[model samples]
Target: MDQGFFLLFATVSVITALMLVVARNPVHSALALMACFLQISAIFVLLEAPLLAVIQIFVYVGAIMVLFLFVIMMIDMREAVLQRFLPGGNLPALVLLVVLGVEMIVLVFWSDSFSVATPATAGGGDTIRTLGTTLFADYLLPFEAASVILLVALVGAIVLARKEPG
Candidate 1:
């Protein structure tokens, strides 16, 4: 049952992620990204990380997606959409994708790290407490720095989206 659920979520996640990349419309792309995030959160739940799953939904699907939609709405995309996609323009991307696919296949098949299967351990009662402590105590500076960076980006987006009065 668990394996079936995992496969279902994993398949949906992959499909949504592909949709996110392939969608031409910015709003549609953002919606696909949100769906991908939601699918990822479901996978996290299957992995027994409920906190991570909730955080994934709250942070990625909620806050980050809202920020993305705001930026998308602020931008004028009609000109971009009107531009035709040249077939030759995709050559570079296709080459990179094929190279990456080959690399991933080689890594998966030849890597010693994945040869051994490790037993899954049950989470302790203090799992969340330990995670919180570690994040706050050791990673607080980096976390705060990331937040500040995101805030700056949001402000920058707003400024760029603002039009000068004639």
Candidate 2:
């Protein structure tokens, strides 16, 4: 990977991520998230993982962004956006974010090879096949569990939508 291109994508990714967090409108946030995902996909491409790059674009940018947009459109967030934030309403969330930030900082600074990229191996030619084999052979249970969990969430969403708001 060219250092200049890597730096460009990494900078754009971080900027877009920050934009996603700072954007007031949910739709704008989703768009910023999509930009961040695209930049990360470019980074994946630089790493010679075309399959992951494509999946990032198709799954995260395309499908997940659409889902976010749909949820944003369906919900009434006008009042939520207009309301003033109370001091302690978000304390738990702020504390959780601080904890996550500390953990990420520790992981990045503590690891000796944090800045080094793994050497490319020979058998990465057939990425899709390799991904499928690894998914089914090594990670089958986790994969199935994720699918089941998503299914349950979808069903729950449908049921909630159909229920009366008594």
Candidate 3:
């Protein structure tokens, strides 16, 4: 049962993630992203972590997606953004793709001898208690600093975009 669920989840996640990247329409891409988030929340439920699943659904699928959709809909010039093309043009894109292919080949062949080992952590599943503890203890200052920085950046961007009197 769990294996089947996991496989379905993985397939949905991969398909939606690809669609999110490949979809020419921005609104469709955002919908794909929302699907991805919902699938991830379902995976969390399958993992027996209800809190993470709730957080994933509420924070990512609900609030974040609504905000993104609101912003996307607010944009009257989405066609212009969609029609925008890459710089250095088609030749550079093809060359870059070739370089990426070579890099992928190198990574696959050269890294054959190296194997990644998982870290030996005691608790595997995420818990709200532990998450809160770590957030308040080890990462408290940095998290607070990041919040202030994001607030400042938001304010600055708004200020910069504001029109001046003629």
lDDT of 2 at 137: 100
Q: List, residue by residue over 61-148, the lDDT tens digit for candidate 2.
A: 8987887677666656765578766777667876876797678768867988756767464474676777788889999999999899
Q: Give lDDT per model, in order.
A: 0.81, 0.78, 0.73
Model 3 clash count equals 0
Worst ten in a row by lDDT for model 3:
113-122
Could you give the C-alpha RMSD of every candidate to the true structure, in order shown? 4.0, 3.7, 6.1
Stretches off by above 4 angstroms in model 1 are 82-89, 105-123, 133-156, 164-166
Badly placed stretches (over 4 Å) of model 3 are 78-82, 87-126, 134-166
**Candidates 2 and 3, the one with greater TM-score:** 2
* lDDT measured at residue 156 in model 2 versus the true structure, 0 to 100: 63
TM-score of each: 0.69, 0.69, 0.59
Candidate topping lDDT: 1
Clashes of each: 0, 0, 0
TM-score of 3: 0.59
